[model samples]
Target: MNQLEALKRWTTVVADTGDFQQMEQFRPQDATTNPSLILKAVQKPEYAPLLQQVVAQGKGAEISALMDQLIVRFGCEILTKVPGRVSTEVDARLSFDAAATVARAQRIVALYRAQGVDTASRVLIKVAATWEGIQAAGQLEREGIHTNLTLLFSRCQAIACGDAGVQLISPFVGRIYDWYKKQAGAGWDEAAMAGDNDPGVQSVRSIFDYYKHFGIRTEVMGASFRNVGQILALAGCDLLTIAPDLLAQLQAASGDVPHKLNAAAAQGMALERVHYDEAGFRFALNADAMATEKLAEGIRAFVADAVKLEQLMQAAAV
Candidate 1:
């Protein structure tokens, strides 16, 4: 079997893209979309019709509502391809507003439902892993709206997500790797940090170990992988949302994809259970410079793309 085939035996591979056309070939069990990805897709000539259709239908509705509809449209298309689920992210601008985040998430779910989607099973409302976001997810979960907490970069975030009883948590792998590598500058040793020693890989591993040890029911889906190595290192995660290029590389490569992360082994380790309240969560997140910076940077990047997407919609409306 090719590496992708081998990896699937242990992990549920998810396509991390707004371009649903790319998903059929990879046969990802699930798919994930963010504002940036949606923005990227709508800009393509082939996807132009999708944007125009949404704009034409939305008419004079608020841009925010139209944005939600567009993403839900993408999610609905993605769902037709993947059998399991599709994560549609909330607007990153509401990352810190629990009430607004919850309201927006409910609206997104309502849009999906209007299209006959089984929101509880076939959709995951993706939210940033802010304390407020987690709290918002907890509220959504209570209402039977499953959530995928995204932009998570710390164990504290993971812990909080688990506490929130979220359906899943996407701890970014590549972004963490990027931050550490950039910080190391000249002292970075690629050879030593390539595989198991990779900081990003280690971060997911630590979160995985903790979740397994505590029997946390929230699934961990490692996202934002930079290369095949990071994906391979996390072969046994609950799920790994990978870009199409890396998925293609794995599909082309021939090798044994090892089950690198073992739940039983994680459970065997001596790990203390950790929980975080609002203040504690804030303090913990603030203490981790990498997590703090990346979380903010990720939110800003997504918000910028969301704005760009709105601009495209406005132009299409005219």
Candidate 2:
């Protein structure tokens, strides 16, 4: 079997892109989309019409609302292709306002429901992993909203999400590497730590080990990765949402892609079950530079794209 097929035997592989058209080839179990990915997808020729259609139908409506509709349209299209759920993001602009974020998430879910989509079973509302976002997720979970907490970096964030009863948390893998790479400047080795020894992979492993040790029901889905090695290193994780290029690379290579992470292996690790109250969460997040920089940077990037998406809607309006 190809590595992709073999990897599935041990881990759930999720396609991490707004380009759902690319998913059929890899046959990923589920798909994830963010404002940035969606922004990139709509800029492509084939997807340009999706933007035009949403704009034409929008009839000079609020651009932000149109952006939300467009996001749903893409998700609706994606769901027709995959058997599992699709993650549609709430506006990152609302990341700080818990109630506003909750409201926006409700509207996204409502749009799906209006189309006869019972999203309670087939959707994961992607929210940023801010303290406010975690609280919003807790509220949504009580109302049966399955949330995928995105932009998660630290154990504190993961613990808060699990404590909030979040359905899942996506700890980014690639962006974490970017922060360290920029910081390392010259001392970084190209191959030695490039793939599996990447700092991003290490971050997710820490979260995975802790979760498994504590038996936390919340799923850990590693996201935003830079290489195939990072994905391979995270084998046996609850799920690894990978970009299409990396997914294709993994499918192409022939090798013994062993399971690198699991409950049994995590049992031998020194990490203990993590407990994070508000103060602890703050301190823990502050302690990790990669997590802190990436968390703040991820939020800023999402917010920027969300703003850009709104502008696109306005420009497409006429």
Q: In the order shown, what is each candidate's alpha-carbon RMSD?
A: 0.6, 1.6
Model 2: lDDT of residue 317: 74
lDDT per residue (tens digit) for residues 56-121 in model 1: 999999999999989999999999999999999999999989999999998998898899998978
Q: Write the per-residue lDDT of candidate 2 for residues 59-163, one digit (tens) a residue.
A: 867776787889999999888878888999998888888999899999889888988887988899999998899999999999998999999877789989988
Please give the range of 10 consecutive residues that has the lowest summed lDDT in model 1: 267-276
Regions of model 1 farther than 4 Å from truth: none
How far does residue 163 in candidate 2 sit from its true spot (Å)? Answer: 1.0
Cα misplacement distance, residue 228 of candidate 2 (Å): 1.0
